[model samples]
Target: MKEMQTFLKKYHEEMNWEISNESYEKTRASLLNNYMLLTTEVAEVAEELRKAFNFTHSHILNGMKDSEAFDLAKENAKEDLGKEFADCLAYMIKFANYFEIDLEESFYKKMDEVKNRKNRDVSLSRK
Candidate 1:
């Protein structure tokens, strides 16, 4: 998707100062020992999802919900989750780029297959 590419371009430019091949390699060595593999991308996505969930539910960590803490959590969750989801998307886009995959076409194809499977299952069940 062009939108994904656009977002990725912006994100890459914004993060250029902080991200580099050496840093990536170090992270890869620590977490995966490989760069830009599907398994590594999946793991990064899962970690980002966990981070977003943690930020959204951080009020629970206080043992009891303080009104102030709950409000702060609510306020921060939106921004934090946005950042985390962006990170997830970045990894997915990177994975697609590394494999030279067209995500938009693949997405539609998979959706069509799923729809066909659902329709076939429903028709059979009515027999």
Candidate 2:
């Protein structure tokens, strides 16, 4: 993950896509714009899921088994889903790079914190 982040940092620099830090206003605008783009990519990920679900439903209606239809739909959507996820990751890495944040370290630290935290939701069980 760290290596990927480093690679993206250099890639973005080479592509001249890094967030601006020229002035406070410029930095603010750049951050907001990038955040919006990230959200758009996220929506594209959701769109891919919707497409897969619709495709699976169509196949099922045509008499295909549920699992087989879903599997085929999932496979068909995999490439576009991956591309959307990559787009999201690129924007996230860009923000992390701009802030000098070590995303790999932060991710592990956060996961550990969540792991150690007490669960809040109560389990429902039938007697």
Candidate 3:
């Protein structure tokens, strides 16, 4: 996760240099814009989901008889899903960076909270 944070920070720096005269903190106000970008990215993910499920409208309307073709489609779908998910992650890192939040630390903290909740649930269930 640290590696991802470092990579995202470097990528954000490069983008800032290419695109803006303002500081990154100044960019925080533009988070609504980032949210819009994330929305579009999520749509792309939905498209990838269609591919992953091999459920295009044409595929649904016209039946498939070939298993080998579907195997290939599945592989391509997996690759597309990976790319879309990475795109989502990039934006999420940007969101975190905008607020100077440490995603790695926050992830661990949140997971610990989730784990404790699960443990509490288990204890209650046993009693």
Instruction: Show how many residue pairs clash in every candidate, following the order shown.
Output: 0, 0, 0
Per-candidate TM-score against the hidden true structure: 0.44, 0.92, 0.66
Q: Which candidate achieves the best TM-score against the true structure?
A: 2
Residue 28, candidate 1: alpha-carbon lDDT:
55
Worst 10 residues of 3 by lDDT: 118-127
- How far residue 124's Cα lies from its native spot in candidate 2, in Å, is 6.4
Q: Over 4 Å off in model 3, which ranges?
A: 17-29, 55-73, 118-127
lDDT of 1 by residue, 21-88 (tens): 46766645533432344455567656655664575466567564666665665565567556656655
| Prediction 3 TM-score vs. true | 0.66
lDDT tens string, model 2, 44-123? Answer: 99999999999999999999999999999999999999999999999999999899999989999998997787984565
> Per-residue lDDT for 93-118 in model 3, tens only?
87776667899899999989988784
Which ranges in model 1 have alpha carbons more than 4 Å from their true place? 6-76, 118-127
Error of 1 at 73 (Å): 6.9
Give the C-alpha miss distance for residue 88 in model 3, angstroms: 0.6
lDDT score of residue 12 within candidate 1? 56
Model 1: lDDT to the true structure: 0.60
